[model samples]
Target: MLIDTHSHIYTEDFSEDIADVIQRAYENEVRKIVLPNIDSSSVKKMLNLTEQYPQICYPLMGLHPTSVTEDYEDELQLVEFWLQKQKFYGIGEIGIDLYWDKTFIKEQTDAFRRQIRLAVKYDLPIVVHFRESFDEVITVLKEEMQPGLTGVFHSFSGTLEQAQQVVELGFMLGVNGVVTFKNSGMDKVIEKVDPSHIILETDSPYLTPVPFRGKRNESSYLVYVAQKVAELHQISVHELARLSSNNAERLFRI
Candidate 1:
């Protein structure tokens, strides 16, 4: 079964037909989807979705980097409180993103570090979102890296050397629709990284795969991403699905 490891189906983008979207996911053989909460505002919607689809949906709790602001401490407290109240598969959609704004770079770093500590505390893997700050992300991961500290760097678009660094640190590279993009450059880097170190994701409601490019994305489209991976690895789509699904299970333990 294919797993869309990082999707925000709880977002307003899917509110109109969330059930239909999820149904399509199942129909397309996307057995499970892991929801990564963006911030405090999404916590309610995220939890609600998990409750509604306990078997097929799981939630990851963490304050996203873009949500990191001056009031980050309060946000962290909320994250910690909720995480303690229930079982979440991971600590993420967390990490640094300097592409949108650099005003909170320091704060984002602090929040990311704190959340990583929380993951360490709870023995949960993390789902990182690194954009225009791969070097900084790697530096932090180096300091925080431990045998038990594992996770995937979602939507990885880095050089092969950087991909090697992430793998060396004991993390998987979360490949998404970007690999299908003609100019992504991820195709070459993914070629170098072992399939075992790669996991598939849709990052849905965004980054739609080719043919669906510039259109709304959903978990059902994961097949296209898998197809691309299969072509790149010279393996069947079923093999790619099995490998990536196994990788997801290994990292998320779901």
Candidate 2:
């Protein structure tokens, strides 16, 4: 069995047939799909999906880095409310994203630290969104480092050094469809990392793997990613699946 540690199929991308998507995920042995909330706009839909399929869908709450505007505190407050209200696998989909716009860097940093504090307080892992800002993300994480800080860098695409640093800091590297891309350069990175520090994810409705490239990604396609990572580690696909799933369970406690 496999667990898709990060996927956004709940974001209207699969609204028409999310059930079918979940079915396909289960059919492909993607037994669990973890959904991360983007902001206030996504909490209800994310919760609804988890409620609809309690056993298969798990929910995480956090403000995404891209959503870090001047009013990010409002969103963070809502995230806090949700955390206090119910159980979440982690505080996630949170981190620095200097890719799309660099204007809100300070806001994003503040939000990231606050959320990290929340994760520490809640005794939950964090799933980070470090897009085009790996150094920035790592810096903040280092500054806020404490006894129980742990999380995953979603859709991790970094060098062997960076991967080593992440694992050293007690974070698992979330590998996904990008690992299967023909020219993404993620394969070389994945090959150097130890499988014990790796976890599987699709980041679906986004980075669809090869052969299924250019198509809307879903949890079911994680197998293609699994196959690639397995090849990189010189292990069987099933073994990779078991190892990645175990890593994810340890990180998310799901």
Candidate 3:
């Protein structure tokens, strides 16, 4: 079975047909979807989905970089509240994102650092989301790196050198639908990486793989990603599933 290490199917995009989405994912052998929180506003819906589909959906708690606003501390407080209240598979969907706006770069880094500390405290892996801020995110990670600090860089689209850096830092690379894009060039980078350091994800409701590009993404489409990554590594899809799923199971303890 394949594990979609990052997905937001709990979001409104799937509200109309969540059951169907989960069923499709299961049917496609894409079992165990990880739900990463965006912010306080998303916590309820995310947790609700987890509660409803406890077996297939696992939840992670964190404040996304884009969600870091002026009142981010309050949001962090809520994140801590949830972390203390219940069990979470990881601390994630958290990192620096300069692609959209850089006005809060300082705040984003601060929040990222704090959340990484939370991951360390809780003894859970992290699911990072960095976009156009690889240097910034890597800097923070290097500064905060410590024993028991581990996680995956969700939707990794970095160079082979960066991938090597992440692996050296003891983190998994989250490969998703983007690898299937005509010009993403992710396949070339992934080709040089070992399967043991890779994991599969869909980032559902976004980054849908080819043959279904331009359509709303879902966990079921993870098979396309798996197929592509398997081809890149020149391995069977079944073997790819085994390796990536084992990476996910170890990282998130799911």
Candidate 4:
């Protein structure tokens, strides 16, 4: 079995053929897929997908970093309200992202720290999405570091030192299709990190792995990623599936 720790299948990108998409995932041995909420707008679809596949899909509650605006506090209240209403498996897709716009960097930092506290309070793992703001994200993570604080750095593409810091801080580095990109150089970083401190993710409908790099990525394509990581560790794909799936189950409690 394999687990896709991060994916946004609920987005309109899959609305017309979600059933087919999900079926393909199962056919490819992807037994579980966690759908992290993007914001208030996506909550309904995200929750609906979980309802549709309660056995295979799970949900996370949070306002994505890109959605952080001047009205972020109000937006965060929405996340809090949902958290109070239901049991989510994680608290993320949360963190800093300056790739598009840096105008809300300050707001993103505040929101990231606040959500980390919420994860601490609820005893849930955080699924972080750090982009061009790795240092910024690490700073808040360090400040909010606590005994019960733990999570995955989704789509992590940092240096070996940063990966080590995250593992040491009790978080797993979420590896995805980015690792398969011929030029990403992520394999070099993964080579030095313990496989136990890593988890599989696709971030699908986005970072499609090679052999299909320019296409719309799906959960099914995670097999290619699993194969790549397994090769990097000199292990079999079956072993990668077993170990990474176990790591995900332990972290997400699903």
Show how many residue pairs clash in every candidate, following the order shown: 0, 0, 0, 0
Give one digit per residue, the lDDT tens place, for model 4 in 1-254.
99999999999999999999999999999999999999889999999999999999999999899999988999999999999999899999899999999999999999999999999999999998888888888889998898988999999899999998898899999999989999999999997787899999999899999889999999999999999999999999999999999999999999
TM-score of 4: 0.99
Q: Please, what are the lDDT tens digits per residue for candidate 3 over residues 185-224?
A: 9989999999999999999899999989999999999999
Give each model a TM-score: 0.99, 0.99, 0.99, 0.99
**Runs in model 3 lying further than 4 Å from the true structure:** none
Clashing residue pairs in candidate 4 are: none
| lDDT tens digits by residue: candidate 1, 80-144 | 99998999999998999999999999999989998999999999999998999999988888887
TM-score of decoy 1: 0.99
Off by over 4 Å in 2: none
Question: Superposing all C-alpha atoms, what RMSD in Å does each candidate have to the true structure?
Answer: 0.7, 0.7, 0.6, 0.7
Q: For model 2, what is the error of residue 14's alpha carbon versus the real structure, in angstroms, after optimal superposition?
A: 0.8
Tens-place lDDT per residue, model 2, 1-254, is 99999988888889899989999999999999999889999999899899999998899999999988999989999999999999999998999998899999999999999999999999989999998999999999999999988999899998889999999998999998888878888999989988999999999899899989999999999999999999999999999999999998888888
Give me the overall lDDT of model 2. 0.92
Task: Determine the C-alpha RMSD for candidate 2 after optimal superposition of all C-alphas.
Answer: 0.7
